[model samples]
Target chain A: MKQLGLSVREDAVGNIFGRWVGSEAELGAVATGSHVDAIPFSGKYDGVVGVLGALEAISVLQRSGFQPKRSLEVIMFTSEEPTRFGISCLGSRLMAGSEELVRSLKRTVDNHNVSFVDAADSAGYKIHPDDLHNVFLNQDAYFAFIELHIEQGPILEKEGIPIGIVTAIAAPASIKVEFEGNGGHAGAVLMPARNDAGLAAAELALAVEKYVLESGSIDTVGTVGILQLHPGAINSIPSKSHLEIDVRDIDEKRRNYVIEKVHKSAIDISKIRGVELSEFKIINQDPPALSDKSVINAMEFAAKQLGLEYKLMISRAYHDSLFMAREYHQWV
Target chain B: MKQLGLSVREDAVGNIFGRWVGSEAELGAVATGSHVDAIPFSGKYDGVVGVLGALEAISVLQRSGFQPKRSLEVIMFTSEEPTRFGISCLGSRLMAGSEELVRSLKRTVDNHNVSFVDAADSAGYKIHPDDLHNVFLNQDAYFAFIELHIEQGPILEKEGIPIGIVTAIAAPASIKVEFEGNGGHAGAVLMPARNDAGLAAAELALAVEKYVLESGSIDTVGTVGILQLHPGAINSIPSKSHLEIDVRDIDEKRRNYVIEKVHKSAIDISKIRGVELSEFKIINQDPPALSDKSVINAMEFAAKQLGLEYKLMISRAYHDSLFMAREYHQWV
Candidate 1:
């Protein structure tokens, strides 16, 4: 509550930080929780739900006269959409002790002109890489970290569950495959003589689909979401094809199996179609984070007291918690 | 021959006509012909061989001081490559009374800035709908038309044949098919939920190849020379695919069968892929032409007199003679 001598700080990039001073014994200590700034129109609950839910929980604790072991802080990060700077979870990723991703984000969408430094500066935010440490200092003082989110998929709703207790967030790997073939006049050429890179790519794509379907890895799956053919003329043979493969699983081993099959299928298709195929692993092996059992027990105990029906479920989507959990392994 | 006082006249497009003066007793004239342009980097023998061969035959007759019952004329038409003007045998087609084909040729390659009038002017030719008859004049003057052309295929050389008398030339039907689908983020979407236009196109192309091979028409064949995926991106689904189908046969019915199968297959693929697909028949049908047996006999007689061996063979490629033969159907 503002009556507790609360104050707020606003950064140049519109990053807002609000604090509620704890008792004198807990002063100079910190506990942090917050959400991102924006979401698309369709994603009404994404970041907004997390920030509002945390604030509501804090208010309830205040109303009940409950006190924490350490100073409790609620924070909202900025530019989490990555829509503006091409860097999703920019605020959290930076707070988790890595600025390396910022370098790569600078070259996003094939544009190298806008560096991460420029993006920050353009948004009127200071580019002090050293100051990033301040964001993590509170992590050590926090007694616990928690995030409340809407179940984006149908699993919880289908089961008629009102709330979900998070267990593990599934990891994903994104792969890009490109095939190169000779471009030539289509009419005068014979099929037997063609390298036909597009055909090769198609065969591989279909094989990937069939492989995933037949593999029956209950915990893993693969999908082809992007396909491109180059020098696409109605009368000229296609010279190149690019395809994207997205495979994910809570079980890393099964995900690896799907990826290996995809690569093998691509190689076989290239050989059969007489074209050269190459594979590029863009996002490799982000392992799933298993939630802390102690936190789950505490949440279940609280749910019982509140008479709220909840179920344990796996997080199929990635979130900022995955990175924060990396810093506090037991919290995950 | 040059010594025989031959007079020449040319149209605006440089289609040359040569007439040799003869005695009044010879009421009709015999025409020997061919075009003189080559395909890009083609062998010199392709077009020039036909013209030079006919000229050599006439030269030998002139040296022998032989006189025929009819006056003989040699002619050379222009723009046979379809490279500069995008239409093959334009001069001959015009001369053979195909005004519709001329109009269709003008419509080729849509969105092209060059108008038909501008294209004619740029090519040093003028097309006036009223003056179309001028190009097709003097139709009854020809007693017979004999054309000499090199075999485009290697069948004659492989069989060690010395010469071949023309029988019929094969006709080809070229068709263009395009499939449109929704393009969206690939990773965030599922296959069953996608319309995947490019995938539908790929299936149709492969089906065409399979159907043509299975049609059991020994001489009937089909090819997909061009396959294009539009707005091709590595992580975005394809929204459109354009395909070119070239089906050919000595028999018109068989070619039509292949074309029909292609259309049916495309429709079926569109339905299966959950995308909208449509086709544009860019090039329709042109029936094969049968050369005149009387003219073949005359050529054979001349070859026999020169102690040369010859065999009758069908032409698998198109030539100006095809249209010319149609024009002089009675004599051809």
Candidate 2:
């Protein structure tokens, strides 16, 4: 931002913004930005491409002697990944004025037991609990929001496409389920006498696949990404098993239906296996977002002028754009 | 042993023996003993009852002024549980002249990475690599061995039996299997594109249950006691999954057959799921032990003389007696 000679500012929740003032600066700004936060063991291209790509775009535009009518802002949203607080798109969720999320922010803690408020405060963003509305952006805060991100999937590569214009972002829901049973010595416990929680979890994991496939949509996908068996030893029958499940789809209703089916299957599996379904929690369920018509038209027109081949595709992996779409009408 | 004025000695691998001298000390000793080591989170009575019960039996014989031509001995074996070195009945296995096991003992390390030899030496039982045979008992060292152990299962209690005469012990096989697949963002990866290792492991776990039940014997049992998914995050598809399986049966051939079925199923699941079966290791498989007819008859005669109700039963949970039966002609 300094090299591009833009005025810089940061929001209360540590969302960094660099604005290039235009002749009509009073009008709603045109924003192009993305998060820099990343998950562990992830590739470098995920969020880095968007953040650096926006800056590069600004540099290129300035070198071309182009001046915008509306102020152009580049934002680096805070905590886009759930790696720290077990919640994604934290900054944008606040900016979108999600009341329930804002109310629960102070109570949220990381795996290390550090509260979200304290972490933000220590990072120089002092959060005011009662006055959290300051972080929320008003209607028409941005004339348009466009993020430049690398495709996170293999679809484009498989089709030998050079570029993809995301038309819609997928909805995602996270669930945690745990089953408990009476554990004993593996050798001492007979097959008929054992109520194994691990087997119950296995049954549920397979059921998640079964239900998602039953949905009959390639856009719909589900994963039992984390499976843990308690007292995990070779000779000890598992007394409890915990699973973290992720389900997503471009269709909100379809995703929710799959989630409901998973819950029913979990209950049925526990009862039949004689294990207790101790917990089945839905951590978050955000609705899908569509790209604005004007934004899609403008991007396609630009691609055509550049003589670049581009495919319009739905984004199964979501981003800060998913939450920002809630606040701004023109978001892609 | 000191209170009873008997000679006490410990072997090279920490097998403690207390011998009550009789009229003919050179005669083969009538031995009765068990291990006191236990796995974590276990009840107090699994191995403890056998050790204490042996001492109580000695006390009762002394009080009755019983005189025998052969000496009576109580031996407390070391490291019966695989809690430390991943090998059960260590002392008894050595005593049974398991040359293959003894050869690997020096290299065996606990979870803390402390070698078995170092652990034994630190406990005041120094071992000599070439002279490991000192720990092996002679074939005729014991005239007869009768271990008084508490039933580890519910069968005796369900039948309200006061005494159970051991007829046979189950053979157990431990297997460690690992599967690997390409991991990616859960949402980004399409259902058809995913070769999920976690799902492969789940299929194998369910297969273990299916095959064990198909064995057509109540004595046959199998368990997937340990399962782990690598880089286990809710939004990350599992790239790797590890499982530790346990299979057991009173009949060795039946147990081995079930293990073969499980292995075949594992390969089939991996191939079908497009995940690599990176590891499929049989850690250990030991033959089953059966009590001598003479020892069972002697126990039955004693119970009948005392007017006690007794039932002949199979021991599903292996112990030091399982290995000790390998060296001695008469073991119960």
Candidate 3:
């Protein structure tokens, strides 16, 4: 554990991992977790809270002069936000041996001109392809890996709970929709003749809202977070529009239905308005993670011992634990 | 006419008049033509065709060695396009002693900043008020005034005829409507939470189209030619929107109804979107003109003498004849 100086050992594509050693050297380790990176201008509580809070918990245990049969280690993962490296949870995804995603993040966010190699070097990281073998080397050695995170949705707050034991992390699929139409002078044109891109985009956005409302499913949620219009002048007819759709659901079927509805609405609006429409599903299937039943039981048992109120809830936000579970399915 | 060189004598507002001496100089003159100035961008045949064509007829008479008992004069009024100096047929209106209209035109577009006297100087014309008085002084001496003009509408064309004798000019009321809404971020704010100035403006625009469609009246037409949205970013929820509504009709009640519908739609949309909305009306009313029955008879008789296909039709587009008839009351 002490061989790497707690310095990151990255893979060929710049997946980074930093390990800390614990007092119990002979027994296999127990991993305590959190991601180190953040979103742009993000509140300190988001990912940092879990990372720092885990460190404090370990420090508290160590200061009390207690030595466990298994060693405890803290991990600081690299590039979780996709802000700097154009990928979310790259470190965890790689550690979990997900080859499909490992290659996909490389080509994403093309406009940023960020190559995987450049991102690693710029962040003072070094990659070693041999180290990837380590991911599969010690599956049985680790007792269990645990992660703490802030519930990003209102479910916990609405339920009047201070802490929640996540049952499963909801899968998120980000979709990009673009509408294209002819641009011209607004004054000289008649309404019936216009193939207005902005109007088409607006109709699609409203349709998404309508779909979600009519579906009457609490688990399904949709958001059109970013909308960009080309030649966006009030006096000029819009020529093109770009929008991002963030859709999520605890159940994959419901999420797929919502996405399918959005796609159909875009096509319908485009046909009605004589506009060309295209949609790219950037995130197709983010598999939801059912929290390790053993982990949930452990948390409940600990909460009872500490006299803390805790409830089991689904995690609306994605986390590294999902990938970890998929990697070591039997262990989870 | 001699005082103004070989050219005809025009009044202070540039209305042209030519007089030919008779065998007995004491005899009164007969005016046999209409104004020379044309409507804005109108066909050359509207007013000028009649005046010049009549002059050619007069030349033919002179060449044939024919002499009338009385002298003949041709007249042309100025500012027929509602020139910078004043409103429709300002020369005829002034000659007819409609001082109230002159004052209104002066105050309206000119705002008294450029008085008619100053406007004349700017146009390189010099005239004394005394000279203007002399021009109108001999109005009672005229035996009769007649006019010729090509009908401006398609009634003649639809009937497969070539010429039209004027019956009446339809009244036109031009109206302008302006709509004013708050702008914000489209992402952070939900559609249900947005005031969405652009959407409200669009609702009003569509309402205008619907009103024109449902009214089912041929005389009434509405146009939304100018629309402006402030800070018009696709990602921005528009804060303010301005739209120009132009409504015109021969019937004042129909015109008022269209304007009223547009106004009500704006208010309704504003309330629905939870935004502040205000409107400004620019243009109000212009009355119709009925052509002189004698003038129509003269034109029809002339067409019959020449064996030309002719029909009586009303003028859809407004003309100086409107104000001329309003002022002179008997000129048409």
Candidate 4:
């Protein structure tokens, strides 16, 4: 970036900012960039595309001899996937004055024995510094935040579109449920007398899908992504079934509503099947964000100027922009 | 057995028979015994108790000088649990002119790479040597075959009975089903677009239980003993489910009726859920056995003479007596 007349700086909390240095340096800068962190087993195209896109745009502007009214800043937020700290948008959370809230969140990352704080500390991060509450760019640092990122959904590829304007960001709330029933010798237990946890669990899993479909919500989804049956033998009856469930939607109420139906079904099944059941929410993240109309319109106008076909999309995967939008109203 | 003045002999196929010299050695023996082998992770007292009970009965008869016109013999059939050879009542199967039949069954023992024959050979047993139609004592060796073994089911324990006289042995007809469907990221896949094999398999399992219960056959029972989901993950929709089903009853027609109903259910579910479904019967041991009426009556009379409470029972577990009864009409 320095070769293109851009100066790079790192914040106290380690957010990276590259400045193109417009003549009017006093005015707040226009920011366009994304994080560089990734989830496990994922391709490198996720956040890297956005960060590199900003660099290329700056290069094109320099070659074209464009003079801006305000400086253009490329900001790379840290740990946007939260795979290491166990919280998404870790840098954005701090810069948005959520340092205290994020500090209180407890998690285990990579199935490691250490807590989230220990891992973050080992990676050279601290929730709060003595001098400042918001260690990186605060809510008022940028006039507008526009990120260029590769769409992670099937829509763009299936529709043959090259560009997209994100309309809203869908966040996740996760929970786990455990069902207990009597285990027996698979053959020795008569069908009528047997209380099989595996059967009950399978029934509950189906019930989850049934009620979700029955709700008739288009954007809503519920998943029993992880299931473990106790004493999983070819010939032995399962005594316990453990599940990790994830429900996500752009609308938090809709997500919670579907989860309520799931809880009700579990209760009914437990009573009918004489199986003991228990469950609790492990994650409760609320305040889903809608894209700023002005920021979206700007992206659409840019696409129109370039004569590129584009679609209005939603980010089912939570991103740093969602946290940034909490304080900075002009988020893309 | 040596303390009781009994001589023991092992056939070429390793069946053990202990005999006390009778006044007339030419008369065929009244044989009472059972195999001492057990299934994996089972109680040691299963067939062992029966073998020891015969030995104790012989000791008592010797103490009382109870010499009969027919000689008394104690027989121990090998591989009765069938875990090692994958064929139940293996010794009896060979002795009842089923040496050819036993040779046809394929099996893997102890999760090893070798076939049942290889395992048996490694343990020192050869099949069909010249000048011998059968390696062990054939059906003609015993005049009356009586076996004393423990009931595997909970009937006696639940009914508060001290003794049980098994009247019939139920045989199992086992089948395996595999369902294949498209897998996807659970969150990204829309509700209507999913063809989840997990849900299909769960529905089919429930269908199995439903059909059996609705059939209203008290003696009938079916089990989905083995279930395996492919790429089982909390965040991924399941693509395949494999199951091993066991349906059993003394009445072959009724058992087959339930199994046929289950197959019909699988077909309906496959069509409804748009999953690839296939199934095949792995075991079809047919021609169920009923204990000899005279033998059951004699056991009942013996229970009455001892003033011990007893009940007529049906054996859900296949036993050596069932195979022996195929040839020895007087077998109990």
Candidate 5:
């Protein structure tokens, strides 16, 4: 930021901002930036493109001698991936005034039992667990926010399209379920007398697909992303099984319905297999975020002027932009 | 054994033996014993009962002033649970002259990458990896062998029988399979475009049950003992999955048929899901061991004389007895 001749500041939650003061500095700033965290075993292209692309765009505009009426602020959010805390958009959620996030932060600990506040403190970001309002953005802090990201799915490449304007981000709900059963020697336990937890997990995985497909909507997607069996020896029956399920759709009600069906299926499968439904936890269920019409129109006009064929599509993958839309009046 | 006035010694591979010399010590000895090792998180009764019971039987005969024509030997086999080296009946398999075990020991390493020879050395047992023939038993070493063990299955208790005379031990086969597919963001990957490896694993698990049930034999049992998904986050599609399946039956041909059907189902499921079957490994498939008729008759006559109700049943759970039968001329 110093090299770029812009003033810089980092917020309480490590959200970095670089501001190019304009003539009317008192007006709401035009903010544009994205996160830079990548998940494990992931590529560099995920969030890297968004953050680097935004910086490149600003550098190009400055070189072309462009002047803005409102202050142009680049905001780099933190921890967009759930790799560390098992929750996505942590920095954006704080800025968006998520009360649930605030409540969770009080007790939320990572796999290593490190509290979020302690982790931030260790990273040179002091946080007051009881008072986190400093991280929340004011209602009219931004005139608009825009983020540039590469397509995460195959749709754009399949259709030979160069650009895609996301109209809405899908609502996502995460669930974790575990089943417990009587495990025994695999060779000794007869099939008729066995209550295998691994099989219960398999049945529920298949059931998730059945319920999602039965919803009769292509937009409704469900995934049994994680399935694990306990005492996982080749000659021992699984006494316990765990599953982490992800369900999403553009329609909030439809997604919730699917989640309910999945929950019911887990219970039914457990009972039928003579196993116990030990846990059914819903981590987070966020509402869909719609793109502002004014921002969409402006992007469409720019794409048309550039003679770039672009498609207006819904983003099934949630991003920091999804949470940002809750705080800002307009976003793209 | 010292307190009981019996000479004791530990052989190569840690097979402990307590011998009570009889009048005709040169005559072939009567051997009776079992393993004392148990798997993780298991009960005290598994192999403990067998070892303690054999000791009690010897003490009772001594108290009765009984004199044996031949020597009576109690043996405690090592590493019968496969908890460390992933091979059960290790001591007995070596004594039974298993060339495969000797070959594997040259390079076989545990989860910690500790070689078998290194582990033995650490355990205060000197193993000449190149000269393991010392562990092999002579064909005429024992006149007869008998092992006292608690029933691993429920048939004896369910039928309200107090004792059971062994007829034969069931054959057991272990298989490990891995499937690989394209993984992406759970929300971003549309249902139609997903080649989910986790789902393929679930399909194969269900297929195991189906194939076993289709065999039309109540004695046939199969279990998907372990299932795991890689990159197992809630919102990431599984790119790879692994499964360890166990199948067993008293009939070798029938068990082999089920195993073949399971293999075909795995390939079929992988093809249908557009996933790659990266690994299909059969760890070990041993044939069933039949009890000697003379030993069975002697056990029946003793039970009748004692007025104890007993049933003749197959031993579904393999023990050191299974491997011992390979070398012993007669066993019960």
Candidate 6:
């Protein structure tokens, strides 16, 4: 921040902001940045690449001795990974007036009974209690915002595309389903009398695969990553089984439809086999985020101008851009 | 034993022999006995019943002032269940001059490095080392051998029949199979490109059920008692799985044929799915041991004379009689 002659500002929620005030400082700032925080064991490329890329872009712009019409800012948001406090983009959400929701949803970090308020109070921002509500950013002052992030999927690498202008981003909505049956000695129980939970789980897994494949395999993907059977001994007929399922697609309605179908089939199979089934939604996040058309066009135009290969792709994994695009921007 | 006018003698291999000398003591002793040892947690009826039944029969004869044409003897064989010492009919096999096989098969009992010979020597049997060979019972010296054992199956109970005269004994021929496959992150891997070991294992389990059911279900039975998977995690595809398989039938040829079919199908599936498969014969034990026809006829005749409902059925399990008939009296 000092090297670029930028002024530093901290939000009440601890979001760091660096402002390089142009002659038209009164005008909206053209923001270019990404979240600095990362998930555990994945700090190398996930958000770091985007962070460095944004800083380098800023440096390049500065060294060119060209001043932008609008002021420029590089902001690093806090807690982009939900692993720490359950919900991601805590700083952005707090500024966007979702502070109460974040507070209500959060219990404690590290199970230490440290409330979000308590954490923010001691986050070293040193903001007065009255200033906590002043964390909201002046969105009207920004003409455009862009986040450079890593592609978490194999799409770009497989296609040999150097740059990707994402049009949509996919987010997960998950469910946990369990089937209960009566277990018995495998040999002692006759085939007809057996209420095998493993069989029920296997059939459910296959059904999930079938439904997902049938519902436009390219658009939606459903997976039973965890299929746990109770009393998993071979000699003992399985008594209970459960699965942790994840389904994702760019279209929220399509994903919901597939989820409905999966739930229906599981229910039908459980009823047919006399196994008790129960399902609960663990996560019901927002629909997929579509990128700003003007911003996407700008990226495409720039790539074309540079004679670079690029793919107009959909992000199959979540990024900090998802939260950034919660509201419309003139040039994002 | 002294009160009952029975002479107690100990074999070199620790077999307890109680003899009631008759006028024809010069002739071979009419042996009537069973093993006193049983598998863990089972002592109510197994060998105890047979041992008591033989002694009761002898007591009844003594009470009736009966003079046997041949000398009568009741012997309690050792370590018949095979769970301990890892050998069935240890005493009987030793008496049959299978001392070398017994010694070779013997291991530390009770997790202690105690040898079988050491156990026998310490078992209160005061015998000269030179007389160890004398422990081999002369089959020609006995005209008959009878062992009355409790039916260890539900055949008699299910049929409501009081008596079950076992005509054959069934033992399992078991094998262990392992399937190896490539494991990867569940979410990152596409369905078509992924080599899921859990899926392979699940399909193999279903194949086992299918193959066993296809074979003559009434005669043959196959079971997978243990299914172990490596790095069992929800987010990771299973990399390896193993199963402990037990396949058994009365006819050795039929059992072997079924085993061969199972092995072939597993191999074929492994090849088709690109999963590495390996199977080894952990136990290639012999098939059912048919009882001596003369003894079966005598049992049937006695049940017939008593006007009782009896089933002269083949034993779908093993007993001391299987080893006793190794090389014994003309009637067993």
- Global lDDT of model 2: 0.88
Q: Which candidate ranks first by DockQ, i.e. highest?
A: 5
Q: Compute the DockQ of candidate 3.
A: 0.03
Q: Using TM-score as the measure, what is the rank order of every candidate, best first?
A: 5, 2, 4, 1, 6, 3
lDDT (Cα atoms) of all candidates against the true structure: 0.66, 0.88, 0.61, 0.73, 0.87, 0.67
Residues B11-98, candidate 5: write the lDDT tens digits: 7888898999989999888888998878665677888888888898899999999998899988898888776766778899889989
Pairs that clash in candidate 4: A225-B233, A225-B234, A226-B234
TM-score for each candidate, following the candidate numbering: 0.58, 0.84, 0.52, 0.70, 0.87, 0.56
Q: For candidate 3, lDDT tens digit of each residue in B1-332?
A: 34312136766657777776566657666665666665333446757775776576667776788776777776776665443432545666566665455445444535357766656767887755445553342445555555666655445656889876666665554333344444543323333444656556656766766796677876565544344555543223456666555455557677677777777777787777787776555443556677777767777888899999987766655555565565343444
Q: Candidate 1, after superposition: displacement of residue B149 in Å?
A: 4.9
TM-score of chain B of 1: 0.83
Candidate that scores best on lDDT: 2
**Model 4: per-residue Cα lDDT over B216-261, one tens digit each:** 8777777665566766655456777777666777788888888888
Output the worst ten-in-a-row residue range by lDDT, candidate 4 chain A. A127-136
Residues A1-332, candidate 6: write the lDDT tens digits: 76777798877666778888888888878777767776543437767776677778878999998787788888787776554444556666655554554445444443367766667667765544456567665567677778787775567788898888888877656566788877654434444555666667767766767777787667676666556666654334567776666677777888788888888888888888788885544544556787778888899899999999998877765655666666546333
The i-RMS of candidate 4 is 3.4
DockQ of candidate model 6: 0.11
Residue runs of model 5 more than 4 Å from their true location after superposition: A1-25, A55-71, A74-76, A83-85, A107-128, A132-134, A159-162, A297-311, B1-28, B52-71, B83-86, B104-129, B132-134, B155-165, B294-311
Candidate 4 chain B worst ten-residue window by lDDT: B127-136
**Candidate 6 accuracy as TM-score:** 0.56
DockQ of each: 0.11, 0.55, 0.03, 0.24, 0.59, 0.11
Which parts of model 2 have CA positions greater than 4 angstroms off? A1-37, A54-75, A83-86, A102-143, A301-308, B1-37, B51-79, B83-86, B102-150, B159-163, B294-310
Ranked by DockQ, the better of candidates 1 and 5 is: 5
Tens-digit per-residue lDDT, A25-103, candidate 3:
5766666667766653334776677677767777676678766566666666655654343345767776776666645
Q: Which portions of model 3 show Cα errors greater than 4 Å?
A: A1-18, A22-28, A40-42, A82-87, A112-142, A158-160, A329-332, B1-332
Q: What lDDT score goes with residue B265 in model 6?
A: 76
Q: Which scores greater on DockQ, model 1 or model 3?
A: 1
